[model samples]
Target: MRLAAKANLGEGTISDFENGYRMPNPRKLAAMRRAFEGAGVVFATRGPTLTQPRWR
Candidate 1:
């Protein structure tokens, strides 16, 4: 819920994406990525990595 709020997307949109039913538009996807980054996630070439302890 927090991630969805931070990404400015409805929970349904994120749930759909997680279930592999749909993808958010590029703008929404970018917002999601930014939200993840703000939460201390690091996107790496190999895969996403956590750079620090989670805040929430």
Candidate 2:
């Protein structure tokens, strides 16, 4: 699915955002994060021992 569709955003929104021509609000940001997570992406900070703790 397209990023916009996966994020439940309007068509072209993702493209615009990727092009730095648009910015998503907090809700949209969360939605985008969820979409990425659904695709098996895990967002986290790298630890000193190469371990990445979970996000929230």
lDDT of each candidate versus the true structure: 0.89, 0.73
Poorly placed runs, candidate 1 (over 4 Å): none
Q: List TM-score per model, in order.
A: 0.89, 0.71
Candidate 1's residue-wise lDDT over 1-56, tens digit each? 38899888899999999999997899999999999998889998999998995666
Q: Which candidate wins on TM-score?
A: 1
Q: lDDT score of model 2?
A: 0.73
lDDT measured at residue 45 in model 1 versus the true structure, 0 to 100: 95
What tens digits encode model 2's per-residue C-alpha lDDT throughout 1-56? Answer: 67687788987777778889989788988999887776667677862232342333
Q: How far off is residue 55 in model 1, in Å?
A: 2.2
Q: Which window of 10 residues has the lowest lDDT sum in candidate 1? A: 47-56
Runs off by more than 4 Å, candidate 2: 47-56
